[model samples]
Target chain A: MGTVAIYSLFIINKSGGLIYYKDYGSAGRMDTNDSLRLASLWHSMHAISQQLSPTTGCTGIDLLQAHNFDLHCFQSLTGTKFFVVCETGAQNMEILLKTIYELYTEFVLKNPFYEMEMPIRCELFDLNLAQVIQKDRVALLGR
Target chain B: MIGVGKAKQYANVLDKPLGRGRQEVSLSAFAFLFSEVVQYNQTQVDNIAELERRLEDAGYAVGARVLELLCHREKGNRRETRLLGILSFIHSTVWKVLFGKVADSLEKGTEHEDEYMISEKELLVNRFISVPKDMGAFNCGAFVAGIVRGVLDNAGFPAVVTAHFVPIEGQQRPRTTILIKFAEEVIHREARLG
Candidate 1:
């Protein structure tokens, strides 16, 4: 079995604030400010795309492809957005995002100290995220 | 009480560096837990108000905990300073975290300056519940109200939160509204501060 090359992850709040961000594989280092700007820009683009949809309630962009990587976005009902950057053909991106969101709900939201619409720095969330990513990697490697 | 060894292990878990997330609870498990809570309160209470109060008391603890956790998550340990800020936090953040969606709407009481209401078309907790007619004006939403009250009281807002069932035309599910009435001191303080 081949490996799943997951590149990075970003979480944006409703008002287009970058709440959480992480890089898994080296997708090249982006400056913090640049990454934040990218998140907000993507958020606006998502809204614009939704507006362009003929349906009244259009779910925004779910997938975007580039030359080398693919971006998969999962938007929660409350408008919190999760974007995962993966290798061009990474499978089960939706499943991965769902698990990530679940981890987020359990650890970050449940933590008594986490503030809303802010950068997620919860220890438990980070640990579980790593575990999930590693587990997926191992599964992909057929170990 | 837990044994010393077990307590120590728990402490160790807490001491571990951040980002180690806890396991997620299934909705069915939560539903079962909530049902048991209601059943337990039903057996213990003589009146609907008493039952609701017990449920509210149970939810109060959850609310208090959620309030602290959500505050930490959103503001990086800083809490909401104003009444409107905290209300919006509860209306948007708390509802979203708890129900996987934000409440339908938030409205101020036209008759009362110190009152506000957060309304949900269908409350997650009440989804599977069918209130018996004999229960007489009882709503399971009291648990949520208790939670809201717990959050506000802990945040130094000191408000009375109550849950009411408002039936909307052509809707099968009765809408749940959590009404908040701020304490006199809170309003006075907010006025002076603002």
Candidate 2:
């Protein structure tokens, strides 16, 4: 079987809590606990990178490229983190992350039941996420 | 103020950011959130005044941050010092951004030296709010009143702000009046400046 281009997408709250996780690929799906660990560890590393940077006004790491897969992250001004893991050469992921942030503001933040900084449980958000993921797939297939 | 446009079926919505600027940090979200705040506070308070006060306190924080942002972006960080100047700023500049239109009126109280009124046909916070039987005369505009007070106080023009409902004879809904009564010091300073 061929390899899946995208692995997963994650949404993290400001304080490094893993608020959301979704897996798209059949390859190497992580247990929930492991994904949670990955989010907090990545959060610490992102913060440390800011502290370690010699230049002023560091915004922390945005992309991590491994041998086979790449991770792209976008942090909103309000400090929520949205990241996606994809094949190393994936395109338009930054725009995709921004789209996710936009949907988040509309469906999640606006939802009255959504307590601030809590896990995302809104079905509207999940429905929109699935649509975004499908669009990502269609875009990649035409490439 | 939020324009709910048709959801254009772009081949990929992720292709670009939504048109112009409506997608960026929605203000409509705040409307729903504010309603939730009112509902939550309703369970906690017994009297209408107390409930409105709680909602106002919540709006105070929002107003303080809004002042900081508007001053930085809209006024080039220049703070207003005079009474009428600041009142006009809130009436025109701040009102436009916050509620999508300039306030209906900014008038001096005929009977009072320091009292001023900024009236709106319907405040966004109170537009959809239906006061309960027990919440009679509550005026969710109290949140907006707090917001006005926060902006004036932060701008160094301290004032006592409150919300009132004045029903028009023909209109089904009463108008919202944000009453701004400047403190003695502010009035004195205005007089001295004059």
Candidate 3:
């Protein structure tokens, strides 16, 4: 349970450029170069997925799993990415992503200070996100 | 029998269609729709003050129509005459008509005769809002201010309604209080009548 932490969140523009990024929890979790590289790679992957998609409009990518960790990327119709990184066996990943999406819609996106395609710095959003992740940890511990 | 027939005929002559009967709306629907309206306006507006002004204007429109409908729905016998009388009427009757409940408290300014206030522990539009830090300039209560303005305008009491978040002790969510300042003409008229 303690092993899970949201390393960062990123928003990718439609053309596959890194628009925003924020790192939470432990300092130096991901280096500057790594963060930028990951964002660019994810942006390109997201665009490719959209182009290859038979259906019209943008959608989300399936959970990407590797040996060390897992990357969960959810995209909005407008091509916004709500990226979450967690342990391989982390439960309720989908629910966590949905809740973050809801928070972005209500607090960040709706907030006037949040410029389009800019990084999010909403205190309320940060607090809510922290609370949600903590709750998930507690639930996992109880189980 | 003759008198009853005459009353019925008079009612028929006076009755006029002002649109459909009152429609029941879900509180959730109003809350969500209003939240969207605030969000939509927040995007276009430049600052907190302008956003609030736009919200007040929006509420003013609704208030005008709501006040008229409320007066029309009354039995037509107990119309308000005095300034305070109409102010109370606006607080209770008009508030209930729009928000489904009267405001928590209504008070007249102690120092100024023309100033009044309506305090609600939790204003409806702000119930779910947690203003993002970047958008520190946004406040959902502007919509409520607009509604108050509408009620005042429709009632022929031109006034400015400003919604503020004044946290009170033991309150969880931010408390919204609407300050209404009446025009000098209203005070003058009240004084003359007295």
Best by lDDT: 1
Q: Global lDDT of each model?
A: 0.84, 0.82, 0.71
lDDT of 2 by residue, B1-194 (tens): 23478555458757743332342344576667776887798789887789878978887887787788778767877978888888999999888878888999999999999999999987877644555434467687899999898899899988889999899898666899999999899888989999
Task: Identify the runs in model 3 with alpha carbons over 4 angstroms from their true place.
Answer: A3-5, A17-22, A31-36, A47-61, A109-115, A121-124, B1-55, B74-78, B82-85, B108-114, B126-140, B168-173, B183-194
Off by over 4 Å in 1: A1-143, B1-17, B20-24
Ranking of all candidate structures by their TM-score, best first: 3, 1, 2
Identify the CAPRI category of the predicted complex in candidate 3. incorrect
Itemize residue pairs with steric clashes in candidate 3.
B56-B146, B59-B146, B59-B147, B60-B146, B60-B150
Name the candidate that leads on DockQ: 3
How well is each residue in A1-143 modelled by candidate 2, as lDDT tens digits?
Answer: 22456789999999999999988874777998999999999999999999999999999999999998899999999888999998888888999999999888877765544678888776557767788888878777776
The candidates, ranked best first by lDDT, are 1, 2, 3
Residue-level lDDT of model 1, residues B1-194, one tens digit each, is: 24576544435676743341353558766765676678767879788889888988988998999888887766788899899999999988888778878889999999999999999987877755656556667888899999999999999999889999998998545789999999999999989998
For residue A68, what is the lDDT in candidate 3? 59
Which prediction has more favorable lDDT, 2 or 3?
2
